[model samples]
Target: MKKINRREVLKKGVTLGIATTGLTGLMRGRAQPKKLRIGFIALTDCAPAVMAQELGLFKKYGLEVEVAKEASWATTRDHLLSGEITAAHCLFGMPFSVYTGIGGPAGRVLPIAMVFNNNGQAITLSSQDFGGKVGFKDLEGAGKAILAKKKEGKPLTFAMTFPGGTHDLWLRYWLGACGVSPASDVRVIVIPPPQMVANMSVGNMDGFCVGEPWNGVAVKQGIGFTTVASQDIWKHHPEKALVFNNEFFRANPEESQALTKAILEACKWLDNVANRRTAARVIGQRQYVNADPDVIDARLQGVYELGGGLGRRNYTDDYMLFHRGGQTNFPRKSHAIWFLAQYRRWGMLKEKPDYEKIAEAILAQDFYASVAKELKIPLPKDDMQPLGGFIDGVTFDPKDPEGSIKKYKVREL
Candidate 1:
């Protein structure tokens, strides 16, 4: 008999193990079948999921992943609800929004597996309005432009990707800080991220808040300019998450863990800075963002063109972060409660829903904790860290959700 190499032996053993399951396994720590569908939007932060597939990280963890590019945030949410995608790179607030009945059909059980990234999203205003006159730190100028347009009967429309999504909350907070009522003083509408620039270019909106590459794309087109990045609203704020439908999470515990491990590795790879240019190239491909790699890489590197002749600004401290030694991927329940409080602050909830209850259900800390341990990732001391670093002065206290709501002066409620 011919002697077999160690590599061949290991490969054959793995093949036999998979063949034993035969592409079928029940939930709860059992083997998962191949082609687990994962969804992502065409924004820059989708890099983690894309990279997981491209680098074979998913396969490394015995997960066969199909990274599906979603058309809109709404579509992504629908897919999550329908279980068409087992997991997704999702807005951190979206699962909360759906749970609270503020943005979707309501009572949907999507569990946030981990935070996909933080910061690097932005608020962009049309060149026709505040392009040269306003930039980051010029909310007063943006306010004035809104007033001028209001008097002129244009009323200065604004757009966000989804109601109660991260973009919506940022627009509402920024508008409120500008002394404009999001509910009454200005009309805020919903548009998908990829379509933000196109809508603004045809005189459809005055400003929009969306994820990157879109903001970068706008600058390249000269139709709109970024006023402030989302990090400007709250530096190092959580943006997107690795969210899975709760059914998939609860039923397939071990499979969920393996997939999370894969993405966590991918996130660590992305934060290396040297790989960002390569990431930009891969994610900017036609199947993903379908935008310019140079445009995408510029912002990924903290280099911004700041169009409308606003000049260049490089962010030394806060750019989009995927994994800063595992801090970026930890899904905290406090952040979930913070989003719930935003719904309360804006009176999106008829009566205050149980914030803690909702947060506990939606944020999969226990699941995340198990995966972090396996990967030897350091977890934060607590999930309930006090959130600060706002352009506005108010800090969110997870201990006092209602009190935090009252602190926002421009709130609808």
Candidate 2:
């Protein structure tokens, strides 16, 4: 995709004939919404959807965006499939799961339009059980202890927001790295992100993997301590994305590109660290994340005061990036391949599916590229990268996805 020069438009100063820029054409073709609804869950990463509506970016792009606060990931998936919501702030893996029939029926194709944010999620472990004994640094020991605890009659349970979602993969990988099988050594359950802390408080789950500020909230409530930040597992990892129903994506290219542009603008605004305090306060209202703005902002700014006597650490370098100069929004095919390989590794797939073909279908590169071209944002030179940056000293080569899967000794397949 050719990266247009915004400076040329600026250099022209809206002169008569020179004013018809690509962005102007994008702005001219306004999308008419009969009932365009967008859904979001209550997590810090939902800021993109919130900001897009609040900051008038959707309006700026001539789109009508109705924001729906979904009860859970499953609800979001249902709305997307039924066409109740046109788009959503959704788990990057949910669409893949649904498409591959991992946790739900197939046929609904939810394509990822733009990634919302990355690296603000974490795994919270019960303080009474895993506070100091098992932390991020001692995962090898944590694996052994978790297995030992499970062997004491009652099987220890771990919770994630959705089946075959990013949180599930992270939790399973952490457990596997610690030399424990998520399926055999312990019980893994699906719970919504907002309910993670409450369930833990009632001793329903020994640990959970979820997005902030729940992890921060759990620490403050003295219920659990953050064992590890998701970024610690994989730095700047893609978490959530703007997902739209397949029909909406393929049928209405103009509307889709307009929506993507609006979201891209919102993402740019969100990355401006200076606006986050206010952003947190806005999204923290009763209709949104519904947590204290202070708690949300703390993690939003990469400050962590881990409870259970665990010290605080700052992760500004890798914490919750919404737009890394458009890199964050550019969905990578390699990331999708990794997630697919993970599904295969865990036996979520009966047999290996066409990983690249599915990834290509899921990532709406056309819409994203059009918006990037309109916005003059440069695309990444390469689609695949040597995805490393893991807590385990391992790297996933996108070229050889099967090899990457086999490298894991604790996998089901």
Task: Point to the candidate with the largest TM-score.
Answer: 2
The lDDT values for all models are 0.84, 0.84
- In model 1, the runs with Cα more than 4 Å from the true position are 1-33
lDDT of candidate 1 vs native? 0.84
Candidate 1 per-residue C-alpha lDDT over 1-413 given as tens digits, one digit per residue, 9 for 90 to 100: 23232244335442211111211322234455577999999999998888878776677667778889899988999998999999999999998898877888888889999999989999888898785677666888887878777778768789999888999999888988887888776788999999999999998888899999999999899998888888889998899999997788889887888788778877887787877877787788888888999999999999988887788889987899988877888888788888888888887986878988988888888888877876778898767878899888898999888888888878877
lDDT for model 2:
0.84
Candidate 2 Cα misplacement greater than 4 A, ranges: 1-23, 33-35
Q: State residue 246's C-alpha deviation in candidate 2, in Å.
A: 1.5
Error of 1 at 347 (Å): 1.8
Task: In candidate 2, list every pair of residues with a backbone clash.
Answer: none
Q: Estimate each model's TM-score.
A: 0.91, 0.93
Question: Mind giving the per-residue lDDT tens digits that candidate 2 earns over 23-98?
Answer: 6776477677544788999998898888777766677667787889999999989888888899999998888899
